[model samples]
Target: MKEFIYCWKDLEPISHIPSYVSLTFIACVLTCVGFLYYATNTLSGEKNNAPVITTTFVAIWLFIITILSLQGFFLDFDFRPPKLFIFLGILMLIIIGLFAFPRTRAIIAQMPITTLTYLHIVRVPVEIVLWWLFIHGAVAESMTFQGVNYDILSGISAPFAGLFLVGMKSKSKLAAIIWNVLTLGLLVNIVSRAIQATPYFHNPLMDAQPNIAVFYFPYVLLPLFVVPVVFFCHIASFYQLIFIKEEEE
Candidate 1:
């Protein structure tokens, strides 16, 4: 077994001084506070309104939370699960039901659109933390450098630079389609690794631990959300137009 050394420059345990639990608690408190403030304002029927979902604000929030989450993972080698995990879990269940049940589709579609909009606000950040854990080469870490360097994109200011480009329009439609095809191809690489691991894919880093149990196919939503939702959601839903035509100014 390789000896593990702690790099104190980037990480500190939440338990020792300011624990991850404490930060989670603070985030929860602030979340509730923010919700209450909005609820009170809405009930008062003020002219100035805050929608339950704010796309631009939520996008920025997701990115900020993701960066902060990396710190917690580095400190403990485990992405600190949220204090509001139950809420998020319920939200996930509703989304899954909406997506999977055709009979529920029409009814679910009628729900306040803002709910899904803001829910993704919360979802994106959580996924980012999970992604960081796998990259950090933790017990469930997949592909990491030296089993310590969590960041595959070490030099770049925004490791997720591709995120910005994925949904944006390019001069080349041919190129755009090609990029999507290439992405789907890349995911196939995991299949080979999965086969090699066989009946069960265990985390080599941890004895008697099965990393593949919770994060199996279909449940392996990290990649799907990355390319399909974040990247392509805007493309089909926001970019190309089949019905609505833009009028010349």
Candidate 2:
């Protein structure tokens, strides 16, 4: 365990943290924006609300970025734990509220399940970014696939499963359900470990180096924006499976 924690010690830190980190950060942001556009368009259908949808998406991103910049929220590790927990708690409540409210539920139910499934493909690049961060000593080793994380598999299989289920018009809802459940489990596993890896929680099982990178600019966007969106995608999938009916084969 100790060896795994200090595995990156031998490797030299990247010479240009800003340049490479900025590239990866831009990639993540663009990927997330693309997914949101696809999802919003899928839900909006032919309502001609694409402009509104796009505006709303940009507005939300701007809001988050503005807050991050103004407050320097990422630099302070002392207050990060409570802030993150509170943000997560509120996010969960909002997700639950969206599902529970009749109007919002109907809106979400209109989204294509296949699109939700495909959205998880973003996780592939997310894992890759995590690996890069691990190498740079920005995050802990345990957070990557090389250590305890295996969430990347879900991202890899998502395209195939989505294609098979949607393209083939398969009636085996059970298969889709199983895949969603398994992937959801993987998401939860990594998220739990990530929380533990934070300096505040500091689980002994995790690496000695706490996950400090996520609290900084650009990288902080991962936890605030990307991770929550992925969680919502999973929840939205489950909701569709339970209440929304599939077409007859």
Candidate 3:
């Protein structure tokens, strides 16, 4: 496994990154799974097998991405549309599809606003991982909080927002909307910076180095799983806050 991972010219050796970094990221992934499971279970209320189906589907998707990343499929940027872009496009489509389908919309409507808000707390550890990656030369400094990335603020404020702003009150609903929008902006800011820091479009504003860590395993999960989940939560929050009546909440 080490050999296959290191064979990629763009990847750093396993020894270069601390074990805790990977462990922490894996923990974050598990936390995401827990969030999704809780949401699905809450919606299901044991009336059906939807939670199991949802978890199985997500696990299979993660497994496929893990296998592909280990095989270095996304590192092949020589093509007209780089595999990285292709992968990102697929993730975007999956998120869009959830919004597009009415069945999924019903599921999203049932997701607890508090859970969606608190789920962002996972980003706090993710920001720490980004810093570790920066120090290890796996990512550009611009992707960390020390640089242009303000996404950490969203993570830090998540708990507070979840605790105070998520309620049935009209003012609370509006505040939730504002919170989700601001955090969603932060998410977009970091994702755009990450794209610019990549090899295909290395903007000088980011750093002297390109952000290549995400092409590797575990790290690839950042873009593949974590960011999309965060994006989904924000959009889901918006749908509920804007469309669902205050009495419904």
Candidate 4:
């Protein structure tokens, strides 16, 4: 274990921003944008409105992330726990507010359940990126499928679940509900392990090398942008399942 940690620590990055890292970061950002476009387009019920809203939201989100990166917010490990909680709290508030507003609730209800399921397929690539980061020794093994992170299973199953939800003329609401619940559990599991592995969490088990890659530029986008998007996707799926009764029609 000591040798493993020593080796990981010794493998320093050649540059702060390498080519593969840049490509992965760009891919992540584009995935977020694509999902936002699909969501706003589906909810707005008008092509023009969808593009406008999608563009606005994507711009604002990107701007916020850029500012955070420029300010080196994610690099501050000492104060990360509080900052992470604050960030997640703000996101949760926004989600709750969207669902609370009647108009937004109606819009959310109109979002296709299959598309929501398909959105989760992005997790497969995300897990792949996590593995890559692990290879570079940027993160702890606990954050990847090689260790405690099993969230990749959901990503693996998402497409089939999505197709099942869509192709079945008489969709099984119970099956969809069960799948969402199980995937949500998987998400929670990885998120909890990630938090525990962070330096701020003071987990002695990972003291030799904590999950610090997420606290840097480009990679920071994972927690700030991608994770929340995934969380919202799951919530949106549940919301559609519970509130929208397709069988009644």
Model number with the top TM-score:
3
Candidate 3 residue lDDT tens string, 1-249: 234323435345444898899999999999998998887788844565668887997899899999998997887666668777777789889888988888888888888888888899999999999999888877888899988899999999998898889843424777788888899999999999898887777765648667888988988899888898889889889998899886765
- Per-model C-alpha lDDT, please? 0.31, 0.72, 0.83, 0.71
TM-score of structure candidate 2? 0.83
Kindly indicate the candidate among 3 and 4 with the higher lDDT: 3
Clashing pairs in 1: 14-19, 14-20
Pairs with steric clashes in candidate 4: none
lDDT of 1 by residue, 1-249 (tens): 111213322332112322343344235334433532343234323443333433333345445434544433222323235222332354345445544665433233322222212222332333334344344332233322323222322113122222332223322334434533443243333333332222133444442212321122112233222222322222221222222232310
For candidate 4, the per-residue lDDT at 241 reads 78
Best by lDDT: 3
Clash numbers, per candidate: 2, 0, 0, 0
> Tens digits of per-residue lDDT for model 4 on 133-205?
7777566787889887888899899888888754346466778889989988988887887777665563655
The window of 10 residues in a row where model 3 has the poorest summed lDDT is 1-10
Q: In candidate 2, residue 78 scores what lDDT? A: 47
Give the per-residue lDDT of model 2 (tens digit) for 4-97: 3233222423333657665776687677677767766766546647536655856686577648744655444445346766666766677678
TM-score of 4: 0.85
RMSD, one per candidate, in order:
12.2, 4.9, 3.7, 4.1
